[model samples]
Target: MHIITRCEEMKIWSLRKNKTPMLHYFLFAYWFILLVWQNLGAGGSANRGGMDVVIKCGLLVMLMIYYFMHATGIRRDILLMCMLLVGVYAIVKIEGGLDLSKILYYFFPFLFVLLIFGVGWKFELNKRQLVHLCNMLIVVVSYIAVYALIFCTDQFANAFSIDNAYGNELKSFLMSSHEYGMYLVFGIMAIILCMEFDPEGTKNRRFWYFLALILFSVNLILTFSRTSILSLAVLLIFYVLIFAKKRLRNWFLILAGIAVLMVLVIPSLRNFFWEIVMKENNDAGRDALIDFGMAFYRDGSVSQKLFGWDYAPIKAYLASSRGLGSFHNAYVQQIVANGLLGVFIMIMYSVVTLYDIFRTIKTKKEGSHLSKFFISFAASAVVFMTFNTAALFASAIDSYFMTLFTVVVPKYVNQSIRAGTFDVPIKNRETRPNVRRVYR
Candidate 1:
């Protein structure tokens, strides 16, 4: 077998008779559009009726073609496991008397999961392409952020004021402040990873990335979502401890100290922290929701306990006075919708993904770009799953990126390992400083 560098692979692909590389770029652009305009309807509702069907169907077709044409191999076990889980859920939905339309809606997640896995497993991009994609994401998100700051700031202030006099959270174009925060988190990670992976550029490149970082960080803070804040903090700490150079680490510490000082010294900052931590009472609401879900499960029959009550009943229950319209936690939601089996499947995938990431980190050289991005993305995924439900299983924007990274990073790691490129430690490498080498 002949091993090829990413640049060489890209060149070869470009010269191929097939237009698969162009198709991949198109798919990436489509995916990016999906992420940016995920919630473009009134009151942050996703317009899932009109063009959404067309987009999804188009994606399904493109993905099938791409997979069959380019995928060198497939993970049969993973594919089969996913199919089995989806099959069980479909059967359960039918048994519970859900409408075909609603059942089809339920199937969207399964399709999305499959599509993401397929693309991640099959499609490959070099460092330059990946960085270009990230740049596109940053530009789109930054535009959205700037638009929100200019047009929506007053609305956000007014909305927050209704809840508390001092509240000033910004939700942007997303459904919630938390959702916007999550978007910013991904943008931040992308900017940071692109900077680290392809750093041998002009001074202007560094300045732009630094500016983007500041923009993303400011928007994240303005969202005022505790989960997002905590997640960002964790990502920064992970990067600083695991990937940052000594000078960067020292600067990070100094910035951390200053943030702490501001939190302590500023009255409004102290009040904001208090509001988020103490006065919000989110834990109580979350606890009640969890208890309700558990009690509902305990009262279910054996079949329901095993295969779940499906979508209709769950929807009705949530619409009822006793339910909160949301499970408030993804794990709990899975249990309610698909029972213990569903939860098991999700947990299995998460465990496998984390295992792969850890394995890559251990085997790959320190400062490996793929490994670092994997760690950053994995950290974000963990935090996103901890607080939100839609990211992994749904066909939303966040889910798109999550699925893309989840599949691509592992494939890249495997390829690097197979080529023996990951075996050499960073300190031992004698590569040129100007060239960025990565797997395609």
Candidate 2:
């Protein structure tokens, strides 16, 4: 009886301290599970009526409820309008528009809103909180990844079966199709983690970060994903060169040492790396897809060319003509699906967020941990996007990260604006100090 009373007391204390319902945690978990499972090709349409649909629907509903709870504003309203337009466009083209699996895309605005305002618009995670959350996530995922590697290798090698205990496919280079997505997510996470630990200032942190780099690098290699391998390397190099707080020469030396060690220690990796870079057929069918997309852009009917082919048409085109699900190139996917206009908007949105993140990095009062981490995150994200379609508009992970940063960064800018500490953007059409104006 005493233990039960103490448990109840603790629960109430946690609730009051966060001032958020327990439901927020549940929704977050559900969303994360969905995110992880997206790589596995789980439910994405209503026709299947699977558990994925149920989970996605639950997430959408919960987020919408959260949005209303926080009181709607014009900014959110305008964003939602744009999202709805895009969602409608995405749906009319796809086969199962309002189905269970595809519902997640339809409600992306809800996800963005929930992240920003679900709990009284308190989405601004300060430097400490961001580092804490990202690092904790990395530690948890990295442990699972390591365990998966050993367990899958042993279990699959002996039994000659596909399934492993850790829920990855044993025989393939990647434990699962989701490996690409995981690489993208965790690759960014690793950069932020290293930035948090100080890329150059301290010896102890450098030691731990190098360990993390090795682990994440190995994880990327084992997955055998060329896109991930390239992106992860780009992220690490950028973190060292652009975001590190230490000496540039030393940073280059450390990166060089790691590269040399990797080549020497992992014989198979050297072969794989060379094959991806030096081999002829490195594009993995991207060339053909681009041809088809460009051809369609040139020859398709007026309406088809304007909106491009809808989802159904594109899927149909792929199946009847080429036999595939997507164009596999994000930029082409945008052009094929929604025409040049949609592609333009998508690019602009990405550019806007990237601009904001870098702008904030420039404003970092020297010696602030937050500035360094933000710069690292931004750099990793930018470099990763160049090589991976996972950052494309169709991917929920890209949308989630971009929207979260968009809303949060502006808050910091608002603080700067109020303090009259305009750091960058010296252009002055109006003689009033060239700081960002606070949204009314």
Error of 2 at 375 (Å): 4.7
Residue 259 lDDT, candidate 1, scale 0-100: 85
The candidate that wins on lDDT is 1
For each candidate in turn, the TM-score is 0.79, 0.66
Listed per candidate, the RMSD to the true structure in angstroms reads 7.1, 11.4
The parts of candidate 2 lying over 4 Å away from their true place are: 1-31, 35-50, 76-122, 154-181, 184-188, 191-212, 257-272, 276-281, 316-323, 366-388, 391-440
lDDT assessment of candidate 1? 0.63
lDDT of candidate 2 over 1-440, digit per residue (tens): 12212222111112122122232243335435655565345533333346655665665566556544533222444455556765655655565445544445434543444344333332223333333445555554565556656756664243323222223322233224334444434545545554654445335566655666666555555454544455555655666666655786486778789977897689765554554332333665768888887887878777666666645556777878765666656667667756776677666655655565556555555333344444544554454444444433332544444333333444443333333333322232122321233333
User: Candidate 1 residues 327-374, lDDT tens each?
Assistant: 767777778767787677667666777776667666655334466556
Candidate 2 versus the native: TM-score?
A: 0.66
